[model samples]
Target: MSDSAPTEHVLLTPGPTPLHPRAVAALLRPMLGHMDPEVFAINDEIQADLRTMYGTAPDTFTALLSGTGSLGMEAGFANLVESGDEVLVCVNGSFGARMAEMAERYGARVRVVTAPHGQAVRVEDVAAQLSGVQMVAVVHGETSTGVLNPVPEIAQLLRGTDTLLTVDAVTTAGMQPFDMQGWGVDYAYTGAQKCLSAPPGVAPVAISERALARFAARRTPTPLWYCDFEGLRDYWSRRAYHHTVPVNLHFAFHAALRAALDEGMTVRQRRVREMGAAIQTALAPLGFSPYVQREAERLPTVLALRLPEGFDDAGIRAALRRREISVTGGLGPTAGLIWRLGLMGEAARPAPYRALMTALEDLLGERGVAARFDEALAGVPV
Candidate 1:
């Protein structure tokens, strides 16, 4: 071994979090070819785990797409939408708006129902607009503003209608409760990085049989091939080649999935939920408040905060970097206006949480906030 020590770095950014120890070890495993029969077995296992993660039916077709979450989102739209279809996209943050854009690109006549950046999408508004809509798309966790939309309630409204519900669960899958069957979600996709504590590249997706039937009956052929449900499903189910699979990422993702299951979904969700809450609650006295005002609507995995007056965004963030800690500033409309702290995966652990608290207090020179944060951290299981 090299004499040099490996410095401990904390990742509070959204994607590409530090890998879990199991994933790290899996990455060093012997490589396999895409054509290797064992590769397909691993794929089957990952798909089954994804179904468990999404709470989909056993027959729900699942696959690990060889792309990022953005591609996964695009594939989701490509499969569900057709020319002239009326797609209802509920936009509360950047990701929601991206879904609307994706729908329009796929030739859907898109209608948008928007809420303020930091608020939840109103189920009543969605209920009023369900007429003639072929599909209703929403984001489960709005990472940009840290708002958790009411997907269950929105899914409920689509129950009797022919409208299928597609959800962007990029940031919530492994760390939160994703009951696609229970919530009546027809299609859902998530990246490997965010809550899975794995490297980015693969996007795990699930499509209910209802959604597949809708794809089968599409008036127009899906314009995209790589993301088309039929081709990809054949590749996964029959080992037919549509595209070169990311075999190495598969190893790491499999390990990550097993780790998540081993920890028990309920326990992991609680850890993520409690970690974000305690950190943000303690921040109250430190001159920081959550960007999303309502507690009920806030996303626990990603915490968006309104920085105190005259807070130095650059200098402080740089200082934290010096301490080997990382967090991100806001994007788009909220840029430089808020800070997004990702209490995801291993970052949700007590050591990192405590380090963040101590660093913030040191940087802000706010002992009172430190006291309150310590008190709050004491109660958090993470």
Candidate 2:
């Protein structure tokens, strides 16, 4: 017997995944005044939860910037970098390359240590680029290519250096293990819409003591008015007048954080990891292969697939969409060569995965590839 059709479209894209019911409910609530005591209380709770999620000390500075993850990235660079300062960027995917570009635009003498698409950047490569660099930036999870860079190793390599290490954990924040303090990451950023299961709008950023020190010691002010770290921090605290805080998004973000904590970080990470392993095992028999060669380097939430020869990338994705399933195509170099499937937040659960896989089986069968729906699903331990 066929599974019942889902009541809503399944979101299989790398981000903006299906929201948790609590998050949706929170989003629907009426907005509060930016200065309301209740709003302040919710924001405080969100900040505390964010610190826990980032694995940082209680005293560490954390704030929700009023933009997407890219704003977080810009805030990290703009607040820390000065003109003529040397900056090194490790680029393995679109997001990594974006860091390099943003650094350059900030007037830093940017140097990029790059790897081929669908692969993680090596610690050795990043180390080689570190000399005289005032800051080093890398993306912890490269959603575009489904590769998780060796962030802890890179952090270890940069230890004791004056050069700060910044990371973009937009896709890895809740799904994978991210210990900013333990890993010695000075600055790390994540989006609300990814593993947080909230809609896009806020970027929850954590700043280390070293990062705060660097910000304090900066010779010049951060150019951007909206995302300036100091300004955001003050606004979140007693100041309360940086910008009109997105009150509804804050509610959604708070609800998502509560849901994440309720699930427990350890369990959530394991769920994503197990689902990812199941996907790999299930697809292997159907002639699909992972874009990232090493299992260790693959991102659990965003799975990049190398289609079998003669399979049309656009055609298959379009077919999936028609069936109310959504997946994304590759970006930049990997474009037209691979497909990206996201198992994130609410969508990371068994029901969504089963819906996606069963639909995929039918699509592959239509394309003349005999995919065993039951056998493939049996591989999923959910």
Candidate 3:
């Protein structure tokens, strides 16, 4: 081995979050063959756990794709749309735009209903543009701008129509209370690295019965074989042989999901909410406010904080990195204007937030700004 040491840091970015000790330990455990009976048992457990977390009916199909969260997005569209199908995508941030692009690539006649970067798409806006739409796509939590779209209202608007609802719940899934069945979301996909605190690679996707019906009725087979829903279902059901699954990452993901379930969804949701509010409170003294305009629409898992004027965004991030703290910069239209701070899973507790605040305090103090870290933290409830 080289004489170099590992550079350790407190991870506070959106995805590929700090892993739970249990999950880390699981990752280090011996690997299992994908076709082994024991591995299939583990897959069964994971699907059950995912179904529970997704808040979908027992009949709803939940599968783990051996790719990032975007893989699910691609599969969701590929199974639902045929050539020249009308798809209405609500774009408020980068991910929504990406979904629109993915759908268009699948031969969808995509109509974009857009909102400003920091705001969310209005249900009325989606309603106004739903003319002969085959499917409607939206992001539940737009991590790019920290905006939580109104999913329930939009689902209500799509009630009587044949249009299916597909949601990108990558940042919202394990971080907050998401009800796939209650909200009538036809398809929802999330990553393990975000709120699950597991290693990246496997994405858990939930599909509703309605979506499965649509997939069954599709005239043409999905050209993408790797992510074909029918093939995946057969593999998961043990009827057909699919590609070799990543056993190690699945181990970590299974442990992470168990941890979430053990903590209980409601309690975990409250912790993230309290922590997010704490971060906003902690940063207020430093003139770092939430970038999203509406307080009600702000995501509790990820905080997109608008940078103070005259503050060097890259410089501050670099300074934090030197101190072994990892935070992310803004994406898409919000770049150079905001900082995306994620308080998720194992990193969502008070200690991490306190450390982040203290570091910010020191960084600002060097610039002749007095950030009252103690006072700001006092507002955070224990």
The reply for model 2, stretches above 4 Å from the true place, is 1-7, 366-382
Quote the positional error of residue 221 for candidate 2 in Å.
1.9
Candidate order by lDDT, decreasing, is 1, 3, 2
lDDT of each: 0.87, 0.85, 0.86
TM-score of 2: 0.94
Query: Over the stretch 1-382, how does candidate 3's per-residue lDDT look in tens digits?
Result: 8889976678888877889888999999887788888878888999999989999998788989999899988989988899999999999989999999999999999999999988989988998999899999999999898899998899998887788999999998986878898888999999889899999898899989899999999899988889898889888985367898898999999999999999888888887877676677666756788888788888888888998888898998899999998888989667789988887788887766667777876887733222443454456543
For model 1 the TM-score comes to 0.95
Name the candidate, 1 or 3, with the larger lDDT value: 1
* TM-score for each of the candidates: 0.95, 0.94, 0.94
> Where is model 3 more than 4 Å wrong at Cα?
1-7, 366-382
Overall local distance difference test of candidate 3? 0.86
Best by TM-score: 1
Tens digits of lDDT, candidate 1, 185-230: 9989988988898889999999988999999988778888778888
Per-residue lDDT tens digits of candidate 2, residues 282-347?
667666798898888888889998987887889888988898888888888788888888877987
